[model samples]
Target chain A: MANEVAADANEHGSGGGMPDPMHQFEIKRQVELDVFGIDASFTNSSLFMVIAAILISSFLIFSMRGRALVPGRMQSLAELSYEFIASMVRDNVGAAGQRYFPFIFTLFMFVLFCNMLGMVPYTFTVTSHIIVTFALASFIFLAVTVIAFARHGAGFLQYFVPKGVPALLLPLLVVIELISYLTRPISLSVRLFANMMAGHTMLKVFGSFVVGLGVLGGWAPLAFMVAFTGLEILVAFLQAYVFAILTCIYLHDALHMH
Target chain B: MPQLEIADFAPQLIWLAITFGSLYLVMARIALPRIGMVIEERRDRIASDLDQAEQLKQKTEEAIATYEQALAESRAKAHAIAQETREKISTELEAERMKLDRKLLDQTEAAEARIDAAKDDALSQIKDVAATTTEAIVTSLIGGKLTKRDVSAAVTKALSE
Candidate 1:
């Protein structure tokens, strides 16, 4: 996509040879795949997802091959990630959320790896897509709702009905609560997607500026790009953290119903 | 934008499900439990080590107490034995001293009796000598041929007066 945009701009002599900053997000088919006629073509996005998964698995499985009581560097990383999510669940959702730790852990590692991988030159970011993040958020929303209903039966609906409100204002408040409750997945998904997309797009744009400006003038945008790249990496980790912690909070609400 | 392109969404979701699901399995089945086991094993090891140390400490205390008790008992026994031996020796010494006193008293009495007898014999010998001398003088002064018996009788009478 970046190549197409660069080609078009050069032909028209309009963009002054600046590649499309949005082009990095374009998906490319790696292997043509069809399942039940569903266009499940394996694209660069899927490939990165697979890479993220494999990397996460290998990092976890192989680093712990020693299972040393005193951990080495890789093992410490694995355990640190494990304990990080463990304590997150323990603190946010209490012990009842322990069973959901693997899911939360996978989610955090997946998003973090994808974001970090996207920072590398010419790698597709899986979390930068809306569908992916939305799918995850919706799944969590549905699961949390199911869990709440399963645990509390009909009392789960009482979550939206605030206590101690006058009957006249109760209906209005209930509608507002229901809307907010429904928007959880949207907010969760957009927060991750927007942060990733905007950061990458901005980096690409600044990177193009560095290329457009020759050596004598390029240093300014290049320096800004360097600092922005660092910020993007931090955002990558922070967004993943935010994603997992929000899931924990949702799970907490579902389990305890407050 | 490629993200809004509807054609890529299905594949992306499919792979997301596949990879995420498998990742969860790997963690749940293999990786996480191993880490938990290592931590659990370390904790158990430390706890058992502490327990063993406590037991050993108690054993040392018990041994020290036993040793002190034995020391005290032996010390008392030695004191009692010394007291008994002192009493026995004192009684034996008193008996020996009484026997020695009796032997000295008997020897002194025998010696006194012998001295008295010797003094009496010497006095009698002295009287015989006196009588003989008196008779001899009388016979020399008075007439030659006086009878020994008469002289002896006269001497006896004078001695008597």
Candidate 2:
């Protein structure tokens, strides 16, 4: 479920001293820590994650400080982000989901900042790691499961069984729903992690080719790299959006069991 | 990639949890509430301002109406005063004309009476002179004394002729 295997790139390391395509994703320890055999050392990855968090908070807090009747550009961006997540939760989870706006909005901004920060020349993509994405997805999955059980009791099982099915097809349908339900964390985590990992790997791969081919022969891959980078930037935003909306959907399922 | 090394997982997960939770705290506690409050405040201010404007407009309209009503009432009062003055002056003028006419009439009657008196006096004087002259002429011619009654009768007869 964790796409932690490094891409095959040692063969292409002939461009001496040129960093590996997957090297940008590596976690290098910055501040070491060990708590009862747990390696909770702060790394470059940790630094970037904290930076993303700080950036999101500052962007929201400072930009909206003036609170103008007519919003300025920075304020508009801040308000747009607020309404975007608010409406996303409202639409997917209904009016009952207003209480969860903060969490959903936070998750969205955190993932969005992480992805966008990765697009910068040197920042690490925290969501690109299985450990991080899986942790987030598993938390959502567990919370939804608990909520579904608490809210609906044993009636939550009706979600997997569905309604008005042929008795012959009931078992088949239930099995399918249960498997699909079990795969939520794996699918959610893998989706964001793969999109980012693949997009970054591809960009580096093409970049390596561009350097390897020298000046005149590099235009093709360079153009592709440009196009791919644009696509990756779009993917970065889209992946965060997809992840947040899916969480809302799960929450809706938990609340409704329909 | 060090991500594959599995040893890095603990560090990244710990940081992710701490960073994400802190961000959530900031958003929930400070950022969102401030923004919502500002928006709500702006909406309330606009609503109150509109209400104030509406009230002012209605008050202005009422004031204008009262002013116009007062102006119209004053205009009507002025017309009544002018009309009353005009009527009073006309009645006074009419009375003065009547008085003057009566005075002129009295003076014309008095002048006529005095002329009649003077004409009567002159006529009597002229008759007396004529009588005296007749008597004197008769006596002078005839050289005889006449009785006063005869002379008078004779004069009267002659005047009559």
Candidate 3:
């Protein structure tokens, strides 16, 4: 019965079949290519990621080339991006964490550019992939954990045992802390991936509806498209913020060892 | 391609390796160093500017203090000179007053001595006239023969003392 519905839906599409909104989440080959023992499939996700990286680097370099005391339009954008990430780090991790400014700034820029790039027509959101986000999150989790141990040595274990808790409730608190600690990467990764995937899928679905409804009746979906487009843009910025903020929190945990 | 469960993990691992390795390299090499250089440069510039400002301020304060001291010294010298001139003028006035008083005292003593001598001479002449008159009246009343020798002898004896 589901197949029937899917087939019926496919019939209405311009193509022989309807493309799954979920299809965008799938990793696939963009070119027939191979490298070494590995299949170098230049997938949509990879393409968009590379584009994001290039755009980030070029934007900063070009804007700062002048390095004017009085910033021009491009320079203001560059400075704003720098200050935004810097402030996030400072607010979360305090002055000591300022040393990690470059790392945090890079993370914010890479994620932000990827998100904004994905919003363009025919672009893939690399951040929407579970693999991508999970890897980024895992790195942060591992790095922060390593830093805590390196800084605190054996005392790192004390982070799990809250200081003021009574002995009776200590075990319970430790369990809760451990569970939360283990779930950090999961929560961080899922937030980015889910929001991006859901928003883009909705957009594709609505976009398809606009085409399917034809010009005269298409105004409804078209209006939804406009509103959803704006919403997606908002989501794009939000996801980057969420990701960067989580990184800062993780860094804070590392620095404070709490 | 048939779906292999192991193949599912392959993409994830590759992406993980690429992301981790690339990010590590970027941070260790390019991004961090550049950022560090920028922040350090800004700090050094601010420090130097503060130092220069401090030096300039000290110099300015020293100049101001020296200027004030010189002005005070000049004012003090002027006051001293005026004070000395006033003292000299007052002493001169005091000396002139004393000199005039001494001259007036000498003239007053001379005038008093002359008047005392004239009074003594006048008293002697009055005694001589009284003696003569008293002899003539005594003789006229008594109706006695009083000779000029006797009268002259008495008048001379009285006048002699």
Candidate achieving the largest lDDT: 1
Cα error of candidate 2 at position B116, Å:
4.8
Candidate 1 regions exceeding 4 Å error are A1-15, B86-161
Number of the top candidate by DockQ? 1
Compared with the true structure, what per-residue lDDT tens digits does model 3 show for residues B98-140? 9999999999999898988888778666665766676778778
Worst lDDT run of 10 residues, candidate 3 chain B, spans B1-10
Instruction: Kindly list the per-residue Cα lDDT of model 2 for residues B123-149, writing each as its tens digit.
Output: 667667776776688779987776777
- lDDT assessment of candidate 3: 0.77
Best by TM-score: 1
Candidate that beats the other on TM-score, 2 or 3, i.e. the better one: 2
Per-residue error (Å), model 2, residue B125: 6.3
- Candidates ranked by DockQ: 1, 2, 3
Taking all chains together, each candidate's TM-score versus the true structure is 0.82, 0.79, 0.68
Compose the digit string of candidate 2's lDDT tens values, residues A1-258: 133332234434643555477777777788899989999998998898889988988898889878898899999898888889988998999988888899999999899999999999767788878888999999999999998998899989989997899999999999999999999999999999999999988988888889888898999999999999999999999999999999999999999775
Against the native complex, each candidate's DockQ, computed on alpha carbons, is 0.62, 0.54, 0.08
Write model 1 residue lDDT over A34-75, tens digit each, in one string: 989888888999889889889988998899898887889999
A-chain TM-score of every model? 0.94, 0.92, 0.90
Residues forming the 10-long window of minimal summed lDDT in candidate 3 chain A: A7-16
CA displacement after TM-score superposition, residue A194 of candidate 2 (Å)? 2.4
